[model samples]
Target: MTDIRHRYRKLVYLTWFLTLDLIMFGAFVRLTDSGLGCPDWPGCYGKLTPLGAGAHIEQAYQAMPYGPVSWGKAWIEMIHRYVGAALGMLIIAIVWMAWRHRHALGHSARLALFTLLAVCVQGAFGAWTVTHKLMPLIVTTHLLGGMSVLALMTWLAARENPGPPVLLSTRRWRPWLIGAFLLLTIQIGLGGWVSTNYAALACMDFPQCHGQWIPDMDLHGGFSLFRALGELPSGEMISQAALTAIHWVHRNMAFLVFLILGSVAWKLRADPVLRRPATGVLLLLLAQLVTGLTTIFFQWPLLIAVLHNGGAAGLVLCCVTLLVRLSRKSTVPQGIQYDKHRHPGSRLAPAPISGTD
Candidate 1:
């Protein structure tokens, strides 16, 4: 059982890292307009690998000579799928191994189970994203789904990483941090909505929408979630004003999210125990702001847009790590610990969430 736990922990680490890579690769696919590269799902052109997708690719080209179909897009989308499949297999192993150790590992086994379920759901969303022609809501939800899975994986990995958490005695840090994290998560979702709808260019000028503080906007149609990429639920072409609304929300909400996360990181830095990591988080927050603005300034360059997506993923992990530490209570607190607060039978485990550690 002990050996199984060790192996389980390694799988947790592997899944968490791979999920991060998959998130960034997903961004590459979205930014490069390769979401429909293969114009199919679960398999690229009815094959497990892109090389085997050749015949289908040729058919795609012939039907729409100047359309989204192409050799490069197929490979890129398939690579993302391949990576996702690898992560899914790792998740399966995690579930089996964790269940095998359930008597000893307790709730961590349950966490592994939930993670398996999440991956399955995420896979379904991935399919809908392609099949629905990248509907704004589906695509945005799909992006969040990936981030959510990554967060779960990170929490799971932290739980299995052999240690009791290093707690900091900061006042009301938990709720404050939680609130900030939630706000940031919402902001990320808004950003995803903007990206999926190609609304980033809706506002060509910074700190203003079309050189006006409040440009013409159709909030009603802009936020309708059930429609295709650029159409209202009524199938009417989404108005330019609607696109402007999407851009404006993401643009302005960024400032509010930054203020919350920045203040939290800055305040946490005052704690001698957390100064280093807090400082690092502050740096990340700043970098996120830069990448976000640069995307607008540079007309949404591929590299900057991809980095913006990666930045959001990193921020989620940082928030989770901070929350995990805050939730801990340790007799000899310093750095991460294992087993004491994480006993299989104990109520809370202080890592990977739900005391899953």
Candidate 2:
């Protein structure tokens, strides 16, 4: 059982790193405008490989010279899909291993299985992202789904920690930590919306938008949530006011999230188990803030913009790890309170001596 635990634990870590890499690559695909490169899903232009789609790629370019289709873009899109498919296979293996050792490993297996489900759902979102023509809502949801998968995998990995879980309630600030994590997640979603809607440069200036603090914005159109990539549901081009609304809201929310995370980091620094993750949280936040500023002031450079997405994903991973490390609950099944007694190494005192004599 111990050997099984160890092997599965290692697999979880590998899957985690791969998941993170996949996320960064997906961001690269999006930032580079390669999202529609293939103009198809799973396969590239009705073939298993992009090279096989040469004629179709050429036709696309010929039809719309500078549109989303290109040989390079097709390759990038296909590569992202391939990596994602590989990750999915890894997750399936995780489920199989978890099921094989379900009894011995307890909830660890359950966590792995749950991750499998999330990956499946995420794959669906990926398909939708392409078929729906990069609809802003779908694209943003796809980004959120990826971040959620990262969080799940991180938490599952923490479940296999060598030591006993260090529940958050032990400290007086557990609620604050949880709140900060949730706030950060919401902020990340807002950031995703801003990105998918192409609203990052809507304001072109920091502190003030369009040379005025709080330029007029259309929150209604900005947050419709059911619209396509660059237009309202009415098929009208999205107004500048709406894009400003998306960017403006995202920018202001960052301050609130920053304050929440900053306070949480300060609290975590005092605990040794928490200090490392705390430092991670702080550094990611700082880097994300810097990258965000550069994206705005410098007119959204590709490298910095993509790195901003990566930083956001990293922040999510750190939060999930911190929460799982601190919380007693595991994604593993155990009827809420883990019955450590059933597992080996459990030191539950023997049932009181029976007096049947």
Candidate 3:
């Protein structure tokens, strides 16, 4: 039983790490404009590999040298798909091991099963992203689906290793944690919208858009979710104002996210058991701020953009870690009491076990 549990834990951690890589790579594919590199789903121009479709790729590249389809871009897109498929297999293994050792593992297999479902849905979205020609809605939804998978993997990893118990009173922070998570989710969605619409450089100025604190923006057109990519609901080409609105909203939302998540991290640092994850959140927040600004100043350099995407995923992991710690059933050792008065501002501190059990 010990061996089985150990194996299952290891597999989950592996999947968790791969999921993170997959998300960042997905960002790379999008940032590079290789999303349509192959112009097909699950294969390159009806061939299993780009090499197999050399003739088709060469023809497409020759026709439009600077277009989405090219030798390099095709390989990039296909490789992203390849990694995604590999991660799916890992998830299948996880689900199998989970049910196989359900009794010994002493936990429900529901999360594992749900994660499998999420990956499947994500795959479907990936196909639609290409077939639909990178429609902003489908593309953004695909991005969110990938993030969802990462979040689920983080939850599974947390379950495998319930860390040291935080004070039972930590439950009071659950609402704040939940709020931060939701805010981060919304911000990620907005960021996805900005990327899908190619609006990252729409404003072209920092701390102010178009050299003003506020710029002319078309909120309705920019946020009309049902329209096709770069087009308004009426089938008109999307305007610069609409694009500016997308970038502007995402930028403003970042400030709110920083404030809320930063506050939660500050509060969490006072708890010894939670300090590590809290520090992680704080550091990630700082890195995100830097990368986000650099992306703007550098005109969306590939590395900075990719790191910004990864930072969002890292924030997701840290937020989930905090949630898992705070939501668990804490078991205080016998004879120990939480001493709020002695610790003053600390969130949790254990009184010495009065006398050993």
Tens-place lDDT per residue, model 3, 1-357, is 879988998999999999999999999999999999999898998999999999999999999999999999999999999999999999999999888888987663879999999999999999999999999999999999999999899999988876557755556777998998999999999999999999999987889999988899999999999988779999999999999999999999999999999998888886666889899999999999999999888899999999999999999999998888887776455345565666654235567846543
Q: Superposing every Cα of model 3 onto the true structure, what RMSD results?
A: 4.2
Please list all clashing residue pairs in model 1, or write none if there are none. Answer: 155-352, 163-337, 163-338, 164-337, 164-338, 349-355
lDDT of 1 by residue, 1-357 (tens): 778677777778878999999999999999998999987787887888778988888888899877778888888988898888899999999888878778877788888889899999999999998888887888898999999999899888766643333444564577988999999889989999999888888988878778899898999888988888778889888889999999998888988888888899888775544566567668888898899888888898999899989988988888777676666555233343334433664233534323442
Model 1 worst lDDT window (10 residues): 345-354
Whole-model lDDT values for every prediction? 0.82, 0.84, 0.90
What residue runs in model 2 are displaced by over 4 Å at the alpha carbon? 164-170, 329-357
Q: What's the distance in Å from true for residue 223, model 2?
A: 0.8
Q: What would the TM-scores of all predictions be? A: 0.88, 0.89, 0.93
How many backbone clashes are present in model 2? 2
Clashes of each: 6, 2, 0
Query: What lDDT does model 2 reach?
Result: 0.84
Q: Pick the candidate with the highest TM-score.
A: 3
Candidate order by decreasing TM-score: 3, 2, 1
RMSD of every candidate to native, in Å, equals 6.2, 6.8, 4.2
lDDT of 2 by residue, 1-357 (tens): 778888888888999999999999989999888999987788988999988999999998999989999999999999899999999999998889888888977876777878888999999999998899998888888888999889888887877774444334335567788888888889988998998988999999888889888799999999998877889878899999999999999999998988888888877776555778889989998998899999998998999998999999988888877776667542222122233554445322222233332
Which is the better candidate, 1 or 2, if ranked by TM-score?
A: 2
Q: Model 2 residue 16 lDDT?
A: 92
